[model samples]
Target: MAKKKSTRRPRARPEAADAPPESANVAQDFANLHVWQIQAFRDILLVAAIVALVWAGYALRAVTVPLLVALLLAYLFEPLIARLSQHPRVSRPTAILGLLGTVGVVVVLLIALTLPTMVRQTTQLVTDLRDERVLARLVELQEAATSQVDRLLGVFSKDETTPDGPETPVTGESDEESAPDGPIPGEPEAGTTGPPVPNGPAVMTEEQVRDLIDERIARERARVAEAEEGGAWWFTPGTGRVARGGWQAISRMIGAVVGIGLMTFLIPFYFFFFSLWYHDVLEFFGRLIPESKRPRTLELLQKMDFVVAGFVRGRIVISLIMGLMLAIGWMICGVPSALVVGLVVGIFCAVPYLGVVGIPLAVGLLVLEQLGLPEAERMGWLWVVLWPTVVFVIVQLIEGWVLTPLIAGKATNLDPVTVLVAVLAGGSVLGIYGMLLAIPLAACGKILLTEVVLPKVNAWTRGEARDPLPLN
Candidate 1:
């Protein structure tokens, strides 16, 4: 009876006996894990991502452009939509239509104002290029540059030959033989050597210098002509009456115009409906998830929405403010095409860090162009020395101390260095469109990863059975 009681007392439940061993094995495996498999998996994912990105770039160019345009337009007008939504009498569709109409009118007015000037300027530029006088002037410039360079080289070469010494003549046999002997030809007597022949340096004759310059000019002109003749096809216009090349260029231009117009036309339509129904769509889709994970999914979506909305709204505000400031500044400086330059700056400002670098550069170039060739040459050095430095300093100061803080705020939580790198990488991958989308996409990705992924990983590390809720 005592032996039977002891055998029963030593027995343990199967679940209880297996639990600790299972967990211990899991811990041991985690501790002794080889990361090569994980790393390989990551590498495979990276390669797949890259391939997908490249394929999407080529395959979805049309859809992508319009979608991006619509997204941006929607973001810009979201505030208006929200405000209009609160109106007692205005329907959402009506409000959206009103905003779209306003945007369209504004855009149309801008194009009307700009197109005439742009066309005139472009035609004038082409005409100027074809003008024989302009070509001659360009040739003259090349000659002048070449001559100046040659003169600089000659001066340096001559300086190299002149030994560093006091103004003393070396006693050479030629000098000794040619020495004056009682009023020799072209020489005064020792007491009166005609101001000692102005002993600082010997000047080359004007005729000889001119001849050297002419030779250098001729060589430069030949080089320039040769290069021009062999230049890219774009630089050379059609040679015959067969307008194939001309038609091709025109067709390309038209295609670009049409593409932009289509983007502009379609974006508002998509944005309006998309914004109106986005919440419903999201909720509907979210319901498919298991009840256990729905809360986390909703939280992730909320964070993503907040991040995207904040960034987009912030960029629009910043771009508008920058455009206003540029217009005002250009007008104050009496710069030509102030409105156009301001508009350009505003458009570019929609981009992040590139705007910071590009706006001042564009303004400086406009200032230089307005100064004209002769004025630019005469006072160009002053502008080259002063204008860019002043403008860039001012722009950076405004961006750092005022605009960026006011618009983007601490919500982005992104460093300037990070923003710049993202923009550059995006630009390299997808050109201008990529650059435009990069920062916002990066911000969204940051929000998703930090609020969604990290919490799960943390819970897993703690041997938790369930994932933790994402941070708001």
Candidate 2:
């Protein structure tokens, strides 16, 4: 009876008993935040990280661009190596070396055969743009054209003088002879001219202006030649950077020919290694993904492989055929620098819709004929412009109707609008290389979102049963 009475005396503390579950589980609650909880913060952090990474990549582009280009080129040439290896007595390494050697020889021959013409044409273009005489000729033509138009409209009337100039024949050659010859009398030339002209600015004739421009161009070209021996493009494990001094440094950095040559030399080596090691490399990367995600990851990888193999490799083939076609057409049409233009257009056409830009560029180069050279040899317009269009259209017809179907086979099923946006975005982000790489990356993204992301999301919403791989 006494022990039962004592039970009522042992009462618990109300504060301890009344404590809320939320306080005890504060860490777990924070860790277990749902997608809706603090979602913006998480998303913002992720976006910031991605942007920072991209900015860093761009900042280090001199290093990264070459590596990426090499990797992609390796993908493009892997099949060729495979085909070459299939022949009896041809090992993989031998095939790689042989194919590369053949490519190098072909390239050297092309350059040796066509470089003089390209150089001559380019020089002419530069001269026409900068020379006052050429510009004067252009002005004369403009005035003549305007007078003709005015007469047609009767705005000048029969009694009126030619618009903005003395009356002249339709050719309007008078102004070409009208440039004043002597320095104006009363003005003093700046700096001493032997004895008299020290107080005023120097007088310049049209010829003098043209000469000065030519001198400047020559000097700049000399600097460009100097720049060819300039600094390294990327850091090396054992070597420090070459020091470049003066304004020439800026030009050298931009022109960096030694770096370019190094990269060119390195490409074949890297390409060979990439093909040689691709399986090992792929396996290593594959092992990186968690076992649970391997199925979807492998699927996406296979999709990317199809695109790289069919589209990227096939583009190289298409470019070669198209370029050869255009080169032959331009040569037949007598277009100057036909080889160079064809080569450039062919290379760029590897990019989707880039052919549009390439075609216009080829046409503009043709129109450079309007500037003509020294009253003698200004011959880019015969069928240079017109025939390129024919070549382009015929190539396009064949490309669309036959080549793409047989070779690339709709590897990139992206719509034109999507391709355009991707190209623009790529260019804005990383320039020419980005433009080159954009479509394949777009295809990868589309595959991931359509086949992986959306399905995962829908399944999650429905709380579907899973078939996750067994954990390692």
Candidate 3:
């Protein structure tokens, strides 16, 4: 018994326990650290990542913008391709090719039908604006308006006495007679001297205007001929400054053309590849998310996709329809450059309420067209104003009642004030691209606030969530 029951059992071997009980307490101490500390670290990391991403995008805008545009195109067209490919007869590649081919055919047809007329009208419009006849008419209207205003003022004045001195009427003949023969000793001559200077808004005879126009045409032709012959078209016998200006203009035009060409090529190249790999691309990004957070993230992303697709696709279709309506209406009303104006208005229509800007543009062009016409042939002022207004109103009504309800269907749900603010902020920060993206971004922000942020705040308030570490 004495041998079997020693007061202290044999000491446990060192191999049975590597560390003391204090090591377990140390782990418990670390686990007791405030939840806010870990959360703060996460928050800081997230903000840093976002800032880095934004900086990278901005720095690589030249490359990124085209890629973004392509991605958007891919987003727009992918659904159609997917649907088409679901048919047993149509493969995805075939679906893509067919859909794209159809779009290409439609676009080519539209260009073939509309381009020549648009080009001719554009040229004519430019010529009309520069016409001596048009200028003389505008001057006459201005003087007539001045005289009418003066007569009205005279009627209201208490003093009827005329000035003592012989009043020199505002007339071309008087200005010409009083003109100096030579340039002022210290001053420069007129910058452009070829077109005859009609003193005091003088009207020129039809023959003189015709002759001047012919001379201008000949000069432009000569410049073109020189350019074709590999000579400096900017150089003329009498002027040196024009050479530099002309060269600058040509350089700018070339730059613009090159930029446009590059964008045209890159957009299609990116779009074709993006469309082919659309699902794969999405899956790649999806894999980046942690498995635990994926389901919630995917839900949010799906909601965002709905909003963006509804807004973008529906708005584009609505705009196109409205543009066609406008063009047809204006053409029937004999508004000059109707196609061009309608296309411009359509682009403006992408932003809510922004299409209103096109009204003044349409009216101004109508007025200009009327001014260039014979008085007998010109539309009444009432018709000129009313027709465009009617067209705009009708189209807007259809857009509001039909297109919005049927297509967009409250996807954004943003109030007008919110939208206006978003548009303004976006336009100020990123110009047109920002403006285009603003509403969708605002919608996404609203979703995040309501779904992610507000719930967290409420829970925290009720002591159901961790308190964020205070900045102070």
Candidate 4:
């Protein structure tokens, strides 16, 4: 055997040439790497991957939003679909299709029932904004605010005035400005400087802020009105026929139509197939994990999924209940656009207490109605602003103390501050989509951390070995 050791290594097997490289299991290539090295590498890769995914998501948000919407709709309708599937005559696909058809019909009925009235009331709102009485009320509000500010300023100022007359807010006027011949009582002259009187029309008056807001709003409203007034057009050069606003409007319209078309085409496409293959999708994702960890992965996934689904569905139900409350309250209060405002506010109720921000507009409409009534009728109408404030307070109490606690709070199990901060951060980063998604995403994250992540981390800390990183 020593003699046979003569310079000959064993021949490689034929199958060896066809064998996959160690790199095929990429982790295997690094099998001999130091633990710290491997950890560093993985950490860097993970950060890079997250960055790439975020960039991709931002770039693909056009398709992404529709896809997400479809996913949400699927989630919303899944229970119903499942229930229907259990019936003798129905299968999953049939159930999905049937439910979608029912949704469509309901949507159509809703539009038919509400659109014309909403349009009429909306027009009335616009016209009312310019009404003399409304303008007078607005002026009265402005004066009241100004007077209140004046009083506030007076508390920090020294005033010398006629005993019979009301004390007015002192200004930064030099005595020379008020009385050129002599220094006004308690006021300094141009030549002499006393302690600076903190004054001058209360810089940036509340009324001024209101005026600025009103001006900006008016400009936007005028622009929209102009667009509506001259919206249609026949023909023109270059663009050949175009919208009333010309090429710009035509382009916008075209873009809008394309977006609508894509949304219409994609949502149903996604929902239909997803509804049919949801379990398959789950399996596909599940199989990405190693056989050993699949059980744990699946368990964790189910928990997160349950949390998200409950939060989403519970939130929607809560919104509906809140909307109903507002609708009934508004109808009883005889608020104009009661249905439209209540529903609009209600549907937006998913974002914690964000919905109540719209109450001022509702209040304004109610105030207008109250003022329009005769004197005797107006007497019974609560103070112009108080009715809306009361309504808002009551609705908020119902939402906070009843609907939310019974529904969304239970669904998410997130404290108010956490939910609010998440919503705000999400809104800052991604606008409406972020706001809508924040709480559910947070819920999922909490579950993931507690169920999936922590368990594995604890196992490692306890010196339990891992094979191919558990997730495979």
Candidate 5:
């Protein structure tokens, strides 16, 4: 009976013909699994990490600035270290130490000489402003010019009788028309005024005019001297007090020293380690990816190196050349502070448009220091206008025709307009530091977008499951 019951087991239920297959079911299950949720969480965590990094950078500028500066120094010197590392007998550490020592010595020497001069010049200028009554004189000159202009305007206004229109001629022997008899001796005859005696020579004699001008100038100078004497209150020791007083100045100096010291100590270390280990670090990271991707990573690194190294090294060479040229030019012109001027010009040349702007300002200031206001007013204008313009034109020519082609070539390849915009944008954001870093950062972004992001986007548009292989 049991056997019969088993044999007569109920017919199995028929599965739905439209049901999804096992593989589809498995995929759907996988989509709902905790593993996928965990992965999503990981992705969110990564994004948050990136955001935190960005926020940290913005929030901690004091810490970030030094690090950024150190990094830049590292980049600048990496190639030298690499070259030294390649030497047969030189150990990497020894080479690094030697390079750092040389750099340090040079920097120390420059600071020792230049800093004292800068401080002395600044202090002297401040003292001169107070003692020479520069502010008062400026105010007096402004007032005198305003007064002279108003007086001239008043005289012109008074001479015009008709307010609304041109002066009408006297047609019927009006009172305005003079009918005086002038036939007496030493007097003009009727209708013989001889064009009003030509106004006693429209031009004054040289000596007369010179004397008048000298008198006016002496008056103006006296006024300026008075004003300057009056404005001497600002420099009075305790007349005006800073909020934190002298302590603030000392604090600022100490802060500057600390900042500079930190940079000095850390920059070489950053440069050395980054130079020695950057390639290996990059290679190690690349190895974490699939073997097929290593070439692409390496290529990106190489391109970045090319852009950064070219900019930094080219700038250094160009700066040196410009400095030498400026020094020679200044010496030829018999300019004082030729070394200082040349150095300033050379340093400013590192900036794009700043060199053009700064050279003139510096020259003008130097000329002012060398010449008094009157002499400066006469000759300083010419020198200031001529030499700076010449220097700028020559520099532009050399940059466009020679240095740019030879050094930068198509490496950075940014358009001039683009570079200017980048500089302005950077200046607006981070000031000088931002301006200094703008080009390299832009280049790096360009490299990243071209090599990393664009290819994936291209593949996705083509419905490809994977990115195309990068060209070496």
Candidate 6:
């Protein structure tokens, strides 16, 4: 064999030689695929790609959220940059830098002015919530509620035919006979600080009330203790382990803050670049679409942009204005944590009536704060309730009549009911971001339904073969 090392290699088996290569067979099969089959495969691939992208976005949200926020800011600020760049002296880059610098300075001023006070108030509020003062107030309120309820029941128990008499709790003779010779069931013990408890037919015994409060307190304390001793890096201060864990936690916290700051700082750069080359980016994406589809696609995107821009930009301005109003109003009314509460309410107000919840929250906080104070220093519940209510009412009136009409306009054009439902649905599915986006998304959906889906459905019903319409 070596002597005659054949110039040619041995041939394959006849069957193997006759058969086409696997790749060629695959190609032939692919070529033979029906049009519908090819379309179906493409659709499946598109769906798979979309699903993969969504999964990746969810998995990487910690990174994606900040980027998305930056993108949103860029989108919001692009028009300003464009307008500024139209001036003879201002180049696009210079416009971006100037605008970003102005925004940065304003933000710094606001933070410097409000952040320390907000932090101090917010910390004090949290501490008050965690302590016994709030719990004691809650108990007193519960007792008062129980007493009122008991009185109401007793009035109903009395004969209706009898003329109205001095209101008194109806303790049946059996209850009085069976009662022990200790202190009355509802009377305050000596040295008690709260309102004198109603003496008569009580709904819940003092022991029962005390036990309920104690149980809740115990559970809360245990939870706080568990959190303090959690498997987190930090632990209660004592040993080397504690020091090491504390350092680790501190370092991690610092790293997180730095990461956030860096991300925030980079947003301006992102905005600058995005604005500078916005047209280039648009053109690049436009090239991907078929020539026939490009105009329609661009039109649809423009419409979406209009809707999103109107809602988002208008809502943000409105929210900021409303928040400022609320903060000032609350501060003027002597509400504790006014800045924090006002800011929260303003943010909530971005979603229409969602801010109504802040009424109860404000009322509760005022009640708690007042109840914690010395009796002489405490504002009556009437004023405590009225101040916040009046502030909210005035702010709402201003917003309904002025700010909304002026700033937000009729961008979404959705009914209040629809807006509420959409917001609730979105919040349930995707938390706060969902709530914020829900209105615009619903509006967009409505447009799609009206412009695209309905027409197709009507055509189908009439047995007409309408060409698949582009979104626009």
- Candidate maximizing TM-score: 6
In Å, residue 308's CA in model 5 sits off its true spot by 1.8
Q: Candidate 5 on 265-354: residue-level lDDT in tens? A: 776667677666766866777779778877777788789889978987887788777776776676565454555666677787787776
Measured with C-alpha atoms, the lDDT of residue 248 in candidate 2 is: 65
Give each model's whole-structure lDDT.
Answer: 0.71, 0.75, 0.85, 0.78, 0.72, 0.84
The sequence of per-residue lDDT tens digits that candidate 2 reaches over residues 29-132 is 87899765787988988999999998998899877777777787777777778898899999888887898889899989988987897788678767866887
Model 5 clash pairs? none
The predicted structure with the larger lDDT, 4 or 5, is 4
Give the local distance difference test score of model 5: 0.72
Clashing pairs in 1: none
Give the Å error, residue 389, model 5. Answer: 3.4
| Model 6 Cα lDDT, one tens digit per residue, 121-218 | 99999898889778889988787779989999888878575667876666799787997777765667766767667766648887898899889989
Better of 3 and 6 by TM-score: 6
In model 6, what lDDT does residue 12 have?
86
User: Model 4 misses residue 449 by how many Å?
Assistant: 3.8
Model 1 residue 168 CA deviation in Å: 9.7
Off by over 4 Å in 6: 1-31, 34-37, 159-256, 457-472
On residues 323-425, what C-alpha lDDT tens digit does candidate 1 reach at each position? 6676566545544455556656767878876555544555554544443466435444345445434654576578668977787676667788888998999
TM-score per prediction, in order, is: 0.63, 0.62, 0.71, 0.65, 0.65, 0.72
Q: Model 3 — TM-score against the truth?
A: 0.71
The collision pairs in model 2 are 190-200
After superposition, the stretches of candidate 5 with alpha carbons farther than 4 Å from their true spots are 1-13, 17-44, 57-68, 111-120, 140-167, 170-243, 288-290, 320-345, 363-383, 445-472
Poorest 10 consecutive residues by lDDT, candidate 2 = 232-241
- Give the range where candidate 6 is weakest over 10 consecutive residues by summed lDDT: 231-240
In terms of lDDT, which candidate is stronger, 2 or 6? 6
